[model samples]
Target: MLFRSLKPLLAGEQHLQLIWLALGSVPVVEFAAHANPDALVLDLQHGLWERTTLEAAIGAVGMHVPVIARCAENSHGAISQALDAGAASVLVPLVETAEDARRAISAGRYPPTGKRSAGGVRPLRAGLEAMRAADRDVAIGLMIETVEGVENVEAIAATAGVDYLFIGTGDLALSRGTSDSEVIGRDCERIVRAAAANGLPCGIFTANARAVRQAFESGCRMAVSANDIDLVKEGFLAARKATFEC
Candidate 1:
């Protein structure tokens, strides 16, 4: 709870940062955390583990930096458990409407503000103050990936307590059935504008340096670098190419 959430980073001058999405392996995740990325997004949705594994991995990250768990879905229990597991924040994916965004936010916050129950691991270990701090220090991130999301993005961005909107444009492209630059760029620009209108930062899951540059140049704030799989593949290809070509 003492650790600052991605909210501050998103609001700071250094809006550019890396987001790690990986399986719920403690050592592997900890290694990513060790690199001190701007934030690490635990891919629980696709990771090969139950929510319990996330709790263990979060402890392993040990406040290295902001650890955000991308919950499997929009379930209230899942969101509550994610934050309770020590994640500085939880990203609810496929959030398409303002109501969906509101539901996710309500589940993440405490009573009066939300229906999230208290007495997570933090509270038991660090006392009542820690549980209280989760609401304050912890942030909420939502992903707008589908067509509906893009359509109502303006209202979603305006939702209070919604920290930032991370664009899941990979799926967006797939949905549109065309990786056309013009199409993607147009959508990205619209999303950025929506976030800007409501004083929220916009983030993109970047595929490379060029994508990162484009996101920043187009008025976006956060640029989540490529995932580990691509990094490993690119590393291997470069190393192999150097040896063979040289």
Candidate 2:
């Protein structure tokens, strides 16, 4: 029933690197945890994770490093399931307005602050103190990826109970109907400024180490630099090239 909290890392000024896990393999998650990144994100939205595997993956990595569950949608069921599975934080996607952000926050929190139900196995096993700790520490993050989201970024950032803001750059680019770096960069910068003005940490989904570093330079405290599937592909390609050269 032990839970590792990500609040300490989020509160600091240092840049935090997070590995995104979408393959839904416990071994892959376990290996990522061993790499000791600042945190690991379980992508439930587009990932291959089922309920049992999600719980098992979190169980395997929760003690080693904090886990942030990126819910499939901004809904109570999605948010609660992730928290119940022992994720230290929940990231809700497609948050286009302040109301959307509020809804996500309400879903992630418990009792007076939120409407999260209390029947998860972890809660029952951990008891009152652990539940209280969860209420006090579990972070709720909202993703700003749509044009509407970027338009209302400031209001979304100011929403009470939102622990952080994340930019879904791929979706953002798609929403804006352009892949132009300058256009995307402007929106990212705007979102970062909005988060800073609200005194909250901002994060982004990056393609590589360079993007991650650029995100940090642009005021993002957290960055999802790589995901399991892409890493595996890269590894295979690199190994194949090396073998051929040899």
Query: For residues 10-31, what per-residue lDDT tens digits would candidate 2 score against the true structure?
Result: 8888899999999989999999
Off by over 4 Å in 2: none
Q: What's the CA error at residue 246 for candidate 1, in Å?
A: 9.0
User: What lDDT does each candidate get?
Assistant: 0.80, 0.91
Q: What is the TM-score of each candidate against the true structure?
A: 0.90, 0.97
Sequence-dependent TM-score of model 2: 0.97
In model 2, which residue pairs have backbone atoms overlapping below 3 Å?
A: none
* Reference-based lDDT, residue 167, model 2: 93
> Per-residue CA lDDT of candidate 1, range 109-135, in tens?
987888888857654687766677657
User: Which pairs clash (backbone N, Cα, C closer than 3 Å) in model 1?
Assistant: none
Q: Cα RMSD (Å) between model 2 and the true structure?
A: 1.1
Residue 4's lDDT in candidate 2 = 85
Error of 1 at 3 (Å): 3.6
